[model samples]
Target: MKYFLPATLSAYLARTYLVAFLQLLGVLLSIVYLFDTVEILRRAAKFENVSLLLVLEMGLLKLPEVGQIILPFAILFSALYTFWFLARRHELVILRAAGLSVWQFLAPIIGVAMMIGVFHMTVINPISAMLISRYQAMEANYLEEKESTVAVGEQGLWLRQRTAEGGVILHASKVQMPEWKLSGVTVFYFSKEGDFLRRLDAGTAVIENASWVFNNAIVNSKGRAPERIARESLPTNLTVNEIEESFSTPEQTPFWVLPSYIRTMEATGFDSRKLRIHFQSLLAQPLLFAAMVILAATVSLRMARFQATALMIGSGVVIGFLVFFASSFLKALGASDQIPVLVAAWFPPVIALFLGMSVILTTEDG
Candidate 1:
């Protein structure tokens, strides 16, 4: 009975925070889906074949990703509401009079927020990735009229490039980093007008001088004898960066698979800065949630004491946007190598955490 009361209060606070968070999330996602559906309809208007069902499906598919994008705001607004609700009913005053510190009660809310972050990172993200990939495919096929151009797998690297005739397919069994060097390279030449022109089997190939330089290549063509060539060159408009950029974006990659994908991209001599930052950001999400909760608590607690509800709510909203913009700026800097990935990914949360702590300490203790 001694500890039961405190435990019950903690559970109540956690439950309240979670319920508020979910309510806000539901509202925000609904708004996002509606706006997105309208945007999809507008974009699809040009394509007469686009159907209403497809548009609705696309909107539904995007909700998970959109939910994540608005997570921080949801946390902030809900935490604010939860704290304010408790204060409005004088529950916090009663708890304080019973000698419970702010941190003791805030602990449960922060814990719930952290659990939400972990769930989002581990469970929600992979589902969002899958759904968003489908959304992108639908968008591309129906709206953009684009085709997937590149892929990497255990078998090797494969590339398809459009030619005026039809297409050219290239495959490499092994790739060397820092330069576009390949072993066991095969190039297939085909035209849309005809089935195929020829195939080239190269023992080694390297991209240089805006072309593929093959060493010890065997050329095979239809109705012709295979010809051996010591050196052969094929013209290519592709650059290494362009090829790298053509692959799926980080948001399209599943969370659990992102680490290995990052390593693979790094091993292939592709720039993995964006992936690193993204992965780091995921790692920092729990702290970000905690920081948001603290900031929300700081504002809500102040509002409760001073009864400046409007000013405090507005301040919380401003803080949320400021944190978002600062994080985005830092991410851009990290992508451009101006700042360290760890710094870019971590600074905003750390700053917010400290800011919230300072305000709460001064307000509550002083």
Candidate 2:
């Protein structure tokens, strides 16, 4: 429980770990950005309206999300590299001979990993979400798709659809997703010149085969008297897939705001399973990062004696990939409601931590 270590040793170890982490992050981000830019360019080439600059902008906007996905890998590699370098320089051996335990030497690196996780969830995620939202909107516009403009907010669900006349704005006080039904709906009709023509209020609206079926509706024209109808059908290009796809992804929501957003989504009768999983996963990030440090130490601690640097590094990466795969698979199960969110989110990191600790104990203590 004692947090004290030799000040100079702690500072040096922490600085080395920090430098390695930052350098690894930079290298990973650069590789990701370059690959993403190339992919985006390939996709954009098919669209006549999308320019090179726009494609680059979209790629940049999407980098944060990609970076987040790769962060654990970055941490794992950085920790491995840092510990290997120290071992190669005989620093770790000297410290061990001086009566320093493995845990004592690992303390600084673990602390740094925890802080990086916190910073990533708090600051980096929100920025990434905002940029991704913008990129999606721009991409939708360039593709001339109505589905991209749909959004759910405090007031209700809002949608924009294009027609031969101009556009239609649809608002619903409440939604039943998966079925794509709406209650307390209002539809605004507009002319081709962007002039408002009339509005229709419906007690309920249901999406049906490329159009919406409104029951118990009242139509009010700009210059005509209001007319009531028992039911009406309006042409729509909105589909079930489009409506569902319009909602901001759980990852797009910031960690700080996820709780409230999850509540709102649940209250509106929308499925919040994905959001719940994402929020829990964010909460588990620090532990996951710490596990990365433990795994790194396990792999790299013997590098000086074995001198199998390449093999050790390769093994570390394989382990990292396995961990990533397991986490993703668990997340998929969580999102589909096959397992409890907490179990899906926390189990991966917890298992990884225990596994890493077991390896370290067997190697270092035996």
Q: Of the candidates shown, which would achieve the greatest lDDT relative to the real structure?
A: 2
Q: How would you encode candidate 2's per-residue C-alpha lDDT over 81-145 as one tens digit per residue?
A: 99889988888879878777888889989999999999988998888888887877776777444
The alpha-carbon lDDT assigned to residue 348 of candidate 2 equals: 96
Tell me the TM-score of each prediction against the true structure: 0.87, 0.95
Q: What's the residue-level lDDT of 316 in candidate 2?
A: 90
Alpha carbon lDDT of residue 312, candidate 2? 88
Model 2 local distance difference test score = 0.87
Candidate 2 positional error at 136, Å? 1.7
Q: All models: lDDT?
A: 0.86, 0.87
Candidate number of the best TM-score: 2
Candidate 1 off by > 4 Å: 1-5, 172-185, 190-197, 201-218, 228-242
